[model samples]
Target: MTHKDILLVEDNPDDVELTRLAFEEANVANRMVVAGDGAEALDYLFARGKHAGRDASQLPAIVLLDLNLPKLDGREVLQAIRGNPATRDLPVIVLTTSAEPFDVEASYALGVNSYIQKPVDFEQFVWAVRQVGLYWLVLNHPRVA
Candidate 1:
């Protein structure tokens, strides 16, 4: 059986490494496609730029997006995803450090499926990642493409 990859759109190296470790701790071994910034995430999703040759039809199980990013912000990326017909229905979860109500409201308006604040503690972070992985990859039934 093949495991569906998780699309992680983040710029911070430490956060990226922590996420990897968290997933590993949770036993979620699915391959992770890490995009350093929002523009690169868009490229991967739309099969443009360096990802032009990738199979655009096979979107990841879910997208874990960070709001603060370079090249393009997560809000723009979320808008792009929702605007495009092909990726409109894809599950996108906002995983960010921001606890601002405005940010939460804005993300929801942009069509994020869920909004989760990053856990500061490693154990809590690992548990959160595990739950998200299980729910999105296993329990949640996305619409058939």
Candidate 2:
């Protein structure tokens, strides 16, 4: 709503750069705000701490979440988001290196919109990120206010 296309919650810098490159390659002119940890992600979403006074109505079209985070972690973050009425239906995609069956099942059970495994190869990773960005940014219809 605030001209941001995606909220990418990731701690790794390399992955973040790769994702940015992929989005650029896709030509999606989206305002991306990066949160290094789950706590920061919540702060950004809830407009807490440094995000205080920010507009809460400016929810991103999609959230690219990583499962393993420093503080709260992705599972707790997802739970918090789902528990909140304001962000209850917000679309979330778990994009991480985790491909464990339990992780996949848990993410799905916890109401993730989608789960994507990070590709190891650089080119493949870029391609995957491009696909994700294109789909979520261009094709997906979020509850735009």
Q: Per-residue lDDT for 1-145 in model 1, tens only?
A: 8987899999999999999999999999799999999999999999999999999998999999999999999999999999999999999999999999999999999999999999999999999999999899889999987
What overall lDDT, based on C-alpha atoms, would model 1 receive against the true structure? Answer: 0.96
Clashes of 2: 0
Q: In candidate 2, what are the lDDT values of residues 35-83, reduced to their tens digit?
A: 9999999999988988988888778778999999999999999999998
- TM-score of each candidate structure, all chains considered together: 0.98, 0.93
lDDT of each: 0.96, 0.88
Candidate 1 off by > 4 Å: none
Give RMSD to native, each candidate: 0.6, 1.7
Kindly report which residue pairs in candidate 2 clash with one another: none
